[model samples]
Target: MTLEGKHALVTGGGTGIGLAIARDLAAKGAQVTITGRRQEVLDTVAAESAGLFGLAMDVRDEADVIDKVAAAVAERGPVQVCIANAGIAEGRAVHKMDLAFWRNMMATNLDGAFLTIRESLKSMRETDWGRVIAVASVAGLRGLPGAACYTASKHGMVGLIRALSEDYLGRPITFNALCPAYVDTEIVDRNTASISQRAGVSADEAREIMVSANRHRRLIRPEEVAAAAAWLVSPGSESVNGQAIEIAGGMM
Candidate 1:
């Protein structure tokens, strides 16, 4: 049950779901390296939590991801648990979406996950056991209206994990994605404003729309997603490979 010797890496670990997962892993005795674009934000969080080290790195930049992950490995040993949680979510109708918006969405949500996992695997492959978990969205499983690019990017993440699972079938490492419905994070807050402006609704009504989208009629908590990530690395989940575990209130 203890990850005393394990080293975990979480991208976008400065806030929201990533921070929750990072703190949870650290509490479980893993030395967690938390990466984000802002050094000050990461440093503040690291200072408040034991076993959590802050590293400033941008997932969208290949060289930054490579060198930063290498630096973390140099300091804390190989990353035994890698979480690709850095992403961006924006909703725009297909007809209204420009190439710039679509590309930026893919770059952060899809390309970022690819780079994070590819770099982490370099060290994780040398270890006896490892875990790679991506914080994808429920949109990964089903098409979502008004967010075509976001949905497509998440679908790519789920496919990546599934394919990697097949490639490493007999290995001790497990690849998986945590698909959660509208979690109560900063992203949701931003989305609420965006939705309100677009739909000509009150901010509260916009937020309520998301809360009602969940089958259980409530936004999810970041800690709920973190719990799923924690369980994936636990000794009991050895056979849970390539699964897109949903934290949604109910099946989509």
Candidate 2:
């Protein structure tokens, strides 16, 4: 279907799943504003894509989120498709975790999503149709060993989407969360190294541990997740609200 005049805003759109979704929306004729902490990264990606525009904004900061999203709306019109995808993942055993680590995880993964969607909704509310998607994780549905904080943050994001979906029921807007298992992103690369150092294993072994965690025993591609996001905003997705759609290989 064509999103000819729709405006989309994707946080962390500089790379990985966010970039894939941003590109997908742009390909479908939406004017996409891709935001990230690094302006250069966003600029480089925007320069390479026709309908993608770069806007540097930190999701963890409420004022920044409000200002940047307003600027984007001013330039591209209302954000008809809002992708709250900016986040960070790290694994720290509960015993070893500190207040700072927990706070940072919540700030980036949970609070960031809340701020991004809240700001996007301001503009989206004026439009007749809109899609709000949160890039949550399988951990949101089930606990992930060794990453309690990350799991909790994802759970919070999923909860936010579900509540918003209910709040906007009967409206032409839908809210959903994409719960994927171990997508092949830079976060996984960093986690692999961290796991290797902490688990006394080789990098390949650490990576294998993650790959094996998936029911299908493989790492998910970012594009696969992007496809799910694309479908959620398509013409026939109006009834798929208040749901946590898992992109995992199989039921986990």
**How many backbone overlaps does candidate 2 show?**
0
- lDDT: which candidate is best? 1
The TM-score values for the models, in the order shown, are 0.99, 0.99
Task: Score residue 72 of candidate 2 by CA lDDT.
Answer: 92
RMSD of 1: 0.7
Q: Write the per-residue lDDT of candidate 2 for residues 1-252, one digit (tens) a residue.
A: 889999999999999999999999999999999999999999999997789999999888989998999999899899999999999999999999999999999999999999999888998998899999999999999999999999999999999999998899999999999999999999999999999999999999999999999999999999999999999998888899999999889988
Query: What does each candidate score in C-alpha RMSD?
Result: 0.7, 0.6
Could you tell me the TM-score of candidate 2? 0.99
**Local distance difference test scores for all models:** 0.95, 0.94
Candidate 1 global TM-score = 0.99
Estimate, for each residue in 95-190, the C-alpha lDDT of model 1 and write its tens digit: 998999999999898999999999999999998999999999999999989999999999999999999999999998999999999999999999
